[model samples]
Target chain A: MKAPVAVNGYGTIGKRVAEAIRQMPDLELKGIVKYTPDYSVLVAYRQGIPIYVPKGKEGVFEEVGVKPSGTVDELFGSVSLVVDASPGGKGAQNKRVYVERGLSALFEGGESPDVAEVSFSTLCNYRQALGKKYIRVVSCNTTALLRLICLLDRHIGVRKARAVIVRRASDPKEDKGIVNTVKLDPPSIPSHHAIDVKTVLPDLDIETVALIVPTTLMHVHVVHIQTKRSTSIDEVVETLSSTPRIVVLEGAKIGIDSTSKIVEFARDLGRKRYDIYENVVWRDMIKVNGDELTIVQAVHQEAIVIPENIDAIRAALRLAESAEETMRVTDKVLNVGLQR
Target chain B: MKAPVAVNGYGTIGKRVAEAIRQMPDLELKGIVKYTPDYSVLVAYRQGIPIYVPKGKEGVFEEVGVKPSGTVDELFGSVSLVVDASPGGKGAQNKRVYVERGLSALFEGGESPDVAEVSFSTLCNYRQALGKKYIRVVSCNTTALLRLICLLDRHIGVRKARAVIVRRASDPKEDKGIVNTVKLDPPSIPSHHAIDVKTVLPDLDIETVALIVPTTLMHVHVVHIQTKRSTSIDEVVETLSSTPRIVVLEGAKIGIDSTSKIVEFARDLGRKRYDIYENVVWRDMIKVNGDELTIVQAVHQEAIVIPENIDAIRAALRLAESAEETMRVTDKVLNVGLQR
Candidate 1:
């Protein structure tokens, strides 16, 4: 079998995937694609790995064709997997180009919903996309969400699930800290991200409400769930812990303020970056009564999609294992790093 | 019996109280206090009732030697009660002249916390201040939190609570459409307000994180709670709804923009401003497995405090009935126009 794969697109999750690939003995470094003039690109460049400057300005990255050479394009054909860490909406077709070149690929969420079966990160719903050409990482809101709902589905059947996402928008250097962008209206629940999840889980009965916060780092989600059978707090935490890519943090030292730290923390402890799980919320913040439970989760918007894109790539390639099995494998790989 | 009490500071909440007091039969037509050189003052002057202006800057009326009508002041008593709608620091006791008057008084939460024996408002622990000499009308963060906690306390026996409050800075006349002054650190929670509650309930336990947001209209509260009983969403909803001064809302609303709209929806319908008693959240947001529950409440900072100021006036007067009983009487008296 080929060694584990190298990842590209280092903005939010890209850097994270790059680090995770480093930890695995099986994965070989292929290359990284970053916008020009970024400090992170310099950091990667100093490390001596091949770094490709994707030709284009912002989204025009899409229309510009990236040709593969023995030094560049040829590598795309050999790499086991490619993760599209490029900003959402900008990397849609580039993901397909990888597929057309016969390279496995993953795309960040927020792109238009794709019909090709693809894998979602640690929640591992890859079976649905096993042997498909395209996959999308669930949105940060959805990534944080589906892992939770899937755990619920395992315990009590979920009749309906609802989430009110109080999302903080990134501080764009160009916008000068003034959020002038008008966003999702009525269907604003992660308005840009939830649509893709619906494409994957069509009948799951879900809705989202997204609000742009004035923060650049992470998205804090206030989640409420309804299950068929009555569930308890302990059961929920335990189920999540048992799942792959999900961390159930219970200590105060780990909170939304330090959510970005989870990834770095995982790295510090020598674990896979995608393995970090849930941040245990304050007890008083949750109002769980019977089958309906309410809680909050803060996700490093970038990290969630990195693993998401990785899983999406696995599905896009129609890897050897079933999608469910691939998801299981990804979860297993993520867990190995979580314990560290 | 008394002339309709004139309310000063008619911006966010001052407006709510002015309207509520207008509906009361016992309160006759005294004009509102205009904060000099503003549209609100213009509105007050046009109303045809005598308006009160402070000693500074040209108002619609001439500045006269103002003596405090003894509530807390030792000077001569003028109005039966002064709703110190003035901003937080300086109270109804304008100067030595007002202080010596011993005038009847009420203070919005901003000023001297010690001055209020019984502070009143739509939310917060009015029950604690009833019959006391000074009542503090709490800030909006306190109102939203206290109402929900009250629900949990009454129904499920709260053990410990913590809240993360996101607040809006003072409104500027220029317009709030383009503004973002968010302080992610030092997020003020209900804890500061809880200190006052603990003054009454010594054993009460809670920790709060307060954050300032860019918007000027609403205050968002993210709460974490530990309860005595494990319950379901229905029980929690029923508990929240049964409380006084709470309006519960479902997430999917069209055309509802700011917290003002949420409160206005209730006020227009003649309902409590804390119209949304419960918001639907997610399962994973629950941090730890405990007797604790997590929830969120949003409040219109101005609206919630107005009634509390009125309640404090009645409570400080040591009216025979408690604030709970008085609220009903006061609401009934003011809402009579609708019944008629």
Candidate 2:
């Protein structure tokens, strides 16, 4: 059985994911990728991991002399499964790039994660990625949607879902320049912009519209969902409250709550390491109306990626006996955060 | 026959609407309402039309100051109907305030024009306003939605509808002030949002979300509709293009044209007096995928409101053979810019 996985792109999410991967017994730190000199990359390098530097912004590591195998025979010739944990939207395309290089591993699909995705929050649909092709890990907001939607999907038959994404203009760290303007992107609605729900159900219909609002850190999604059959919002609340990975928040009864406080709560909650049976869920930003519900949810991107990636390597490469076995391993990793 | 209908809140749209309403044969000018005096008000006043103003905002009129009754009723009571020319969304709460005062006649729900209202936009279930208890005008975006949806309901049978609103932020001259984010409004989804549309269809299942962006003149709505019956998007476009009172422009193969350019074109097309009958139907915005179609549309808030107000007045007071006849009379009393 494979004991270690190499992670490329040691950016914001990559470092933590690298640590979490190292923690898995079925996994080892084969190597780490850093485009240039970064603090954590230097640490990992000193700790005896080979640090690969691929030159240029559009530098696909395969092009450089220190490459990731030229063909499928080459990838299988050296490494195990590759978890390319880079950044947002463009990264999905990057995953496609690696797959083109015979890295036919899957992450999570916003519409349907086809391959082995280490989906966080109850590991919803982790089984679907088993022994599959390419797996696409979703965006942070997409992860929040998976956690919330799976809860609703099982308790109530969720027929259709639509979400509006109000994203940050500048990153909390990326002080590239100064500008402020509310912009709407993909300008078109994405049919699968909803979730990494591929594992649980294929051929699902979830449409999403994303907008980039001027903010930073947490990305807020104003989500409204329609159920197949009508159910009271009271039932909706019960369904949400019962879900461990999801935090069902009640929004301010008067004015709209600021994005500032919502993200803070999610960051604090992520620290909890309770088992799936006893996780805390706060319903502060959840707005419900009959079978139709609207939610304002925020997720700290850094914390979500690591656990998901670890589980991905476990499930995709068949290191775990089954998805349940992978979960037990993921639960133990999550335990590290809870104890702190 | 009803005496002249005085136009209230004569600004960008109100000015043109007042001119249109004044041309009716059965309607005559009673007085005019102004917040801050401008060239338009002075011209209407010079023509012997008494202009009423709110107490403090009224220093411009030199004479015995006719205080604005502090409430809408002070003005609404004397007029046959009040055509609120305030900016879009600006009048929602205000409309609610006056509807609470109760109508002397129907506003539009096919209730009592003598007590309720009968707005323009022949497509809306204005007929329902005939015998209703209260009548309220919907937002301009909703107006465009109703217009486009009616075409779908007739040709394809609407199963579901979704609308995304991109709005202008500041009203440097016309629409002013930060009104705060949309808060605690039930039917947060437009199908359920207010205006009592159920008073008509009773089965209109619509979901709408609003976004505040940076713009001033026009609002754009991206609409996706799923039909019960399968009809090609070409058929849908053909139907929309054929629909009267719609401006369907032809250009571009990629996506619908931008919002600003759409409205400017409409303003130009709207210049033909007969455009009230032959509207520039928005054809460029339509896209078909299997049974689902998506469209990008822009509607001038100015055009939707003042005309509706004028029509509501004509029916509410039972002053004319029809609001159309009244509009013919009102057109002679005022003149504003119209696009060709």
Candidate 3:
């Protein structure tokens, strides 16, 4: 029997995570939590996914011509695991309810590090989260950073690293974005992303500065690292490309030059919501100068962490023994390499 | 007795160069070249600056109710030096005219480095440009990079540096810019900027990757450098702040966070055209870990190089013997420290 799972909060990440759960044969999407009777909830209902509302707020969904599958309390009670994909900062509060009901829960990057026993990235520390009560999946930027940094460190031993993130102001559907402005998010150095990376890869020395641009398509990262050994750009490319969910494309050769182009390429591939579920790295932009390495890549903000969230679900429930095993199952089911 | 200079091509950089030339007591603005009759010419005429039209294009200006002060040939013949502010890629074509007229010319960064005797940034290589027949003022981004890097290097001894430039798509006035996209300008690593910086600081080890974002206000740079010795952030900030055109502002403390806010602050200061001629470094964003340093700064693309252009004019005309002397005269005349 499939492990029944609940996705709390049907928002950007929650909706994507729910669909991912449904795709996995090992997991069953028991229900999704909704606080409002909005158009999104109606669409979710039309898609045949059950909706769960607050115990007293069931009337709101019924008024919108939708019946609640169960109350949020019932969601926690019925499912063995719950993915807290609520809006940022809501996960910490919802953690209390998960503990009260004796359920394993996955919190997103927005929650504090202390909210979970371990901060997780599938490639970096998936095993660290096995059978844990709570797993905090690092943010999109941090996940992207860990994936690349860890890969390089495992092969060449990264001595130190620095990154500058050109972050998108908002997701495409969100209206509140910086228009005609490049904002220094936090207006400080080593923006929260740098600190978040440490939560997963504690020994790796990394510093990051981030700025939010007006674009809503994706976040671009320029990463530099001093490695213990010398490597060629071609060698680095081969290693990074061999990994699953890391698509290395030659920008000059393929005419893929912008974040918008990456999304359109996914659209051309007929991806759902035009989501690029991989780190779209510009192959030619990876420069290796002896022991020093630099890479330029783009992370689709909406989808980069989706697979990690899926990996977290398995690790938290002890569904798989190792990260490799979990990723193999998850990757095959999601068709993660289709874009490559 | 002031050196008479003619500004070739009355466009974005040309008009500003002409006005700056007029302001410097050591230089006189003789005339400005116009390729076609446009509203800009009318404004220049209204400002009482002499407008020189192409020989056959004089009729077009007269038809537009603007009188041409002289032919382009006369403008070239009258001035001792010509500052080529024509559109990008046009500087090479105009080089023949300056040569034919036997006049010294200062080309903007858009022109190839080979077009001039040496590539110049006011602080980095001003003396190299002194009395040179043709001096190419490095691009705005390069000027900003050199200003900070050279300052830090002069004090701490830079071992190597890497920068990821979040470049503004267009000047505020230009209508053609990337919309809703973060474009890799060259779709390649070490985008021409790394090569351009090499033109001036040939021996400095530096790599740069640049992306064009949808912002017209300013270009932001995330710079990382490994110094030969350890230093504190306070020392780096103090050393960089001591420079004439470098303005270090505490972003979080001052409530200045975005490129738009930096431009707005300049406007609040009643700056001409809301131009911030300084490199606006976030005071708290400069981080130091042992010998490695990371800095986040915004370069006002439209105005950051204006002061360098003025300093180049002084250096090229042999009015100043050293970089310090040239900047001293140029900075005082233009009030370069007003933003600081």
Candidate 4:
């Protein structure tokens, strides 16, 4: 029997999670929850996925001419797992509802680790989340970082890591009043990212500073990692290329020169909303100087976490015996890494 | 009296060099040399800058309905310095003409070090090029690399360096039939960029790989430098921030996020062809992990060499006694780091 899962909050992350859950063979998307009768609510309805509204906001859905199938409270009893894709702080508020119903839950990166039994990254702590009542699937940025770090750590042992996140201001669908000027994160030294990554790999030394730029395309990351052993650029490339979900982009092989072109390639391939589920690393940009490895990669902020969400479902419920088995199934079913 | 300077070739590099020379108070735009009466030749004519053609191509200009002021031979006798902005190998051919005329000439990075008396970068070797007969202003990529390297070497010694060049396939005007796939420079290992940078900083150990991406906007570089001494990300940022021609972009302050938005910002600023002449370093992307310093910066391929061309003119003609004075004048006239 497929494990039933409900996606709460139909924003960028919520909508993607719902679609991914529906695609997985081991999971059933019970319904999607939305606070307002936005266009996504209509999309969820048209996709034949049931939609639920917050307890107090049910009346507003009819005013917007769309009928939600039920209230969010009704979703708790029907699903074994509740994936909270709500806005940053809202996950904490919604966690109470899930806990009271004794349902396993997954929260997005926006929430604190305290909100869940454990913070999760499929590559770093997939096994840890198994049989856990609550798991927080790390944010898109953390997921992208973890993929590289886990690969490097496994192959050559990462001694230290640093990253600069050129973040997108907002998702294409929503407007949060993106600023025009590039400003440093306030109290800038060791931005919250460093702390977040630690939750997965507690001993790893990583420092990150994030800047929100005015483009809705994707977040570009410039990463520098120092390896424990000597390695060459070619060796580093070979290692990363072999890793799953890490798409190595060569300008000649893929005919894509920039992140914008990568988006175009995805759209041309008829990907869902041009979503690139993999971490697009510039194949040419992977270099090793002495023991340091450097790479420039683009992370599609909205889509990267989608696959992780799917894996987190199986992980939270102990459905998959191993991460490799879960990742292989997810990639095969979702067509993840086939773009290249 | 202004020193007369002639720019040979009417491609991306040549046009910018001609315009920059025209704007400088210390130099006079003698004439621009074009092998073909392309649209850019017409542009030079419309801008009231005198246009010259290769001896045999003079008639081609009139056939294309654009009048040439004289042959390239006439430019040799009229100018004190000739900046060879021609195609890669063409500069070697033009070098013989400059020698025959006893005219001091500056070659673009396309030419080998053997073609010139010294390889010049305003930040690295302006003094070395002073009063020299022939000098090659390093390529846009080399110039950008030198800017970071020189600063790092000065603040904290650099033990070694590695770089991945995410290069643009073509300039905005030309269509070089850019391929979609990311390709390593054929015979891939260490691209010529590794050697090219050594021309400016011979003692610095560095290795690089270049891939041509299908974007005319700019080239993004992922650089990792192992500092001789340990450093912090804040110290690295402060050092780079103080360097001239290095624009540190913070996502919050400038609202400029991606390379495309940067192009848009340049266009909104009413820049020449929306060109970003400086090396735009993402402030948040600079990180020092252990002993390794990492940065991601964008180089406007066509425009980066423009300022170096101006400085080369000064260096070749002995117009400025110090690089600081020449750079100050060039920045004042061209508005180098004011994009933000």
Candidate 5:
């Protein structure tokens, strides 16, 4: 029998995670919790997915002309795990209810490290989340960083890494952000994203600084890593190209020069929702000088972490004995790295 | 007697270098070469500075109502050394004339490293240029990176250094640049900057990437350096604060945040031409975690290297026996670090 999973929130990540769960053969989408009876809740209801509401909000759903499937408690009691994809800082408050009912839960990056048993990035620490009661999949930026850093560590051995994160001001659907200025995200050095990466890869020495630009499509990381031993550029290129969820685009050959062009490339690829689930690395930006490597890659902020959220559920439930097994199953279902 | 010096191009860097030479007690500005009979030629001519023209372009000077002081060959014969501030790539072609006349020349960062005997950064290797026939001062961005890296290396002993150069799309007076895009300057990795830094400091390991934002004021560098041993934040801050041609500004206390604000601060200080000759470092961006030091500094593209050009002349002429003496003399005459 497939293990039933309930997504506690049907917002940005929760909706994507629910759709991913329904496609997996080993998992089934039990229900989704919605606090507001807005257009999104109506859309999910019209799609034939079960919608659970709070105990006192049944009248609100009825007023929207959509009958609720059940209460949030009923959804929690029926599923094997709950993926809490609520807004940042809200998951920490909702954790008390999940623990009171003896339920295993996975939180998003917004929660503190204390709220979960393990801070999870599938490529970096998948086994650590196996059988854990609470696991937190890191933020979108951290997931993008780990996928490259961990892959390099496994092949060429990374001794030190530094990143300059050129961040997108906001998601595509958001209306608020800087209009014409390049603002420092925190107005400080070594922003919080660096520390979050260390929560999973404790032995890695890395430092990062972030700047929020006016663009909203994706975030670009200018990364420099020192290898443990001397490695050639061809070796690094081969390893990343042969990997599962990375798409290498040669700027000189294909004319993919900017982050905006990468988004248009995704749209041309006919991806569902124009979403790119892979890290888009420019082949022209990869340089290997002796033991040091420098490269530039762009991460689709809205969709890069969706696949990791799926793998987190399998790792937390012990559905697969190893990380590679879970990744193979998840990558195949998501059609990750196949469109390229 | 003041040593005679001639400026080989009266453009952006040449005019500033000529003015700096005029203010020096031990150096005299003999004349400046003007290729175009533009409005700037009239300004320099009215200032009582001699204007020299190429062999055949004497008519161009006559068309602009400015009488030629002499020919380019005459300027080369009169000066003890010629500061070759010609346009980039033009300096390489003009080097043969200086070599033929047996005149020592100082080239700007635009020329190749082979164009000079040493790639120069005043703070890193002032002595390396002493008594040299040809010296090339590194580019503006490379000069900015060398200042902080060499400073930190002195007090904390830097083991590895990495930089992300956020470049201005163009100088303030130029009309050619990106309109509303953040472009990778070369659309490649490890931009020529890292190798340029190594040309001055041969033993230091460093990597750099550059991005061109749609701003014309100044270029900012996000730098990370790993010290040879563990150090505290106080030591790194104190080291940078006590150095010449470097300014430390607090973001919270003074509300000095972005690079644009730094220019405003310099304007408010009533600086001539609103030029900030020092590297404006944000205090809030200085962080030391264990052995790593991270900093964000803004280098005014037009003015930061003017002070270096003065020190380069002193070093190349053997006017000062040590780097510290040259810096002290140059910094005092330019009122560097005085506004703060």
Candidate 6:
């Protein structure tokens, strides 16, 4: 019998998580939680995925011409695991509900590391989250960094890393206007990313600064790493190419000159919502000067975390014995790194 | 008195060089040389610039319903200097003609450093090319690399450098099809660019690999440098911000997210041919780790060489007393770094 999973919150991350969970072979998606009646709720309904709302807000969906199946609190009794994809602080609040009902839960990146027993990156810390009551899949930016840094650290031993994240100001559905000026997050020397990555790699000497660009497509990261020993550019490229779910792009051969082109390529490939779950690393831009390595890559903010959440679910349920097994299953089912 | 300057081979670099020379206060635009009467030749004719052809090809222009002013050989006598913006290997062949006519010439980067007395980059080797009979302005990629390397070497003392040149397949007017696969130039360990930079900074140790992507807009460069001393990212950004022809783009502000947007921004700002002559450095993408610094910047393939040609013209004519004076005049007339 498949384990039942419920997605709480139907925002950017939640919608994707719900869809992914619905497709997984080992898990059955019970329903997705909605706070209000939005276009996404209709989307969930049209897809035949049940929708659950908060007790009082259930009628709001009816007023908007959509009928939610039941209340969000009722979902806990039927589901064995809850994936909390709510807003930042709300995930911590929902943890109380999950704990009371004796349910395992996975939290999205927006929640603090304190909300979970372990911060999980499938490639970095998949085994550690096994059987944990709560696991936090990292943010898109941190995931992009970890995907590359973990590979480097495993192969050549990364001593220190510094990165600048050129992030998209808002997702397509969000009404927030694109920033007109580059603003550094306060106490700007090192942004929240520095603190967040440490949750996965406790001893990583890393620092990050972020700028929100007006793009709704993806986030571009300029990463510089210092390895414990010298490595060549070819070695780095070879390692990255071998990694799962990391798409090393030859922009010239594939006609992907920019992030927009990459998005168009993804859409042309029939990706749902034009999502690229893999980190798009410019194959040509990877270079090593002595012991220092530099790479330029892009991360699809809405899609990258989806796979990690799936892997986290497997680990939390003790379904996969090892990280490789979990990653292989996730990649095979989701077509994670298959680029035409 | 204005120096008579003739531009040979009106292709991507040639046409821009001709127009830039036409607008300069110190130079007079003589007829431009044409091998065949193409659309560009018609463009020159419509702009009222004289068109000269090779001795045998003069009739070809007449056959195309375009009148040629004279033969290319005649241009040597009418003009004191020739900027040979012809195709690669053509510049070396034209050197014999310039030498035969006792006319000084500046060759484009396509030619070997041996083809000229000194390879010139206005920012790096302006003084070296003064009163030289033959000077070669390095290629667009070299010019872009030199611009930043020279700045870093001057401000913080660069020890060594490595770069990957993500090049465009062809200019917008060329018929070369975009590559369907990313291709590395043969013997990709160190491309010609590795040796090209040495033309300006003979003592600097640098290596580069190049990949041709399918795009006509611009070339993106990923650079990593090891400085002689440890320098903070803030200091590096400050030094670059103060540089004349390097435009530090706030990737967050003004919504310049990708190269296409930067091109669009240039068009909106009413840039001629949507050309961005300066290096578009992402302000937030610059970072420092230990003694190493990394930068991701885009170089406009056509326009970057234009300003350097203007500065080279002044140096060839013994017009500017210093690199500063020449750069100031070129920036003032061309509006080098101004972006909307």
Per-residue CA lDDT of model 5 for A220-241, tens digit only, reads: 8898888999998789888787
Please estimate how well model 3 matches the true structure, expressed as its whole-model Cα lDDT. Answer: 0.87
So what's the TM-score on candidate 5?
Answer: 0.82
- From the highest TM-score down, the ranking of the candidates is 3, 5, 4, 6, 2, 1
Please provide, for model 5 over B1-340, each residue's C-alpha lDDT reduced to its tens digit, 9 standing for 90 to 100. Answer: 9999999888888888888888888899999998879988898888888999988899878987999999988888898899999989999999888888888889999899999999888878888889988999888898888888888888879998878888887788888876434567678767899889989988888877888776777887888888999998778778888777788877758777667677788899898778888888888888888887788888888888898888888888899877789888888888899922
The CAPRI class of candidate 4 is incorrect
Q: Write the per-residue lDDT of candidate 2 for residues A257-321, one digit (tens) a residue.
A: 44444444445656422112122223443445666665555555445545556666665666665
Who wins the DockQ comparison?
3
List residue ranges in candidate 1 displaced over 4 A: A1-10, A33-40, A52-72, A95-100, A119-121, A171-194, A251-284, A312-338, B1-76, B84-166, B169-217, B220-340
Candidate 2 positional error at A129, Å: 3.8
Report each candidate's C-alpha RMSD, comma-separated, in the order given: 9.5, 8.1, 1.6, 5.5, 4.6, 6.1
Residue pairs clashing in model 6 are: A252-B213, A253-B180, A253-B181, A253-B182
Interface RMSD (C-alpha) of each candidate? 8.6, 5.9, 1.0, 7.9, 2.3, 9.2
In the range B198-249, model 1's lDDT, one tens digit per residue, is: 5334576765545454566456655667788776656666676564455445
Q: Rank by lDDT, descending? A: 3, 5, 6, 4, 1, 2
Q: What is the lDDT of residue B2 in candidate 6?
A: 88
Docking class of 2: incorrect
TM-score winner: 3
Candidate 3 residues lying further than 4 Å off, grouped into runs, are none
TM-score of each: 0.59, 0.65, 0.97, 0.77, 0.82, 0.74
Indicate the docking level reached by candidate 5.
acceptable
lDDT for each residue of candidate 4 in B238-334, tens digit (9 for 90 to 100): 8887756888888446666557778888899899789788888877667677787777787888898888889988988888988898988998888
Model 3, residue B296: what's the lDDT? 86
**Tens digits of lDDT, candidate 1, A23-59:** 4444566776655446665566666655655433434
Comparing 1 and 4 on TM-score, the stronger one:
4
For each candidate, report its DockQ versus the true two-chain complex: 0.10, 0.08, 0.86, 0.09, 0.32, 0.06
Docking class of 3: high
Local error of candidate 5 at A295, Å?
A: 5.1
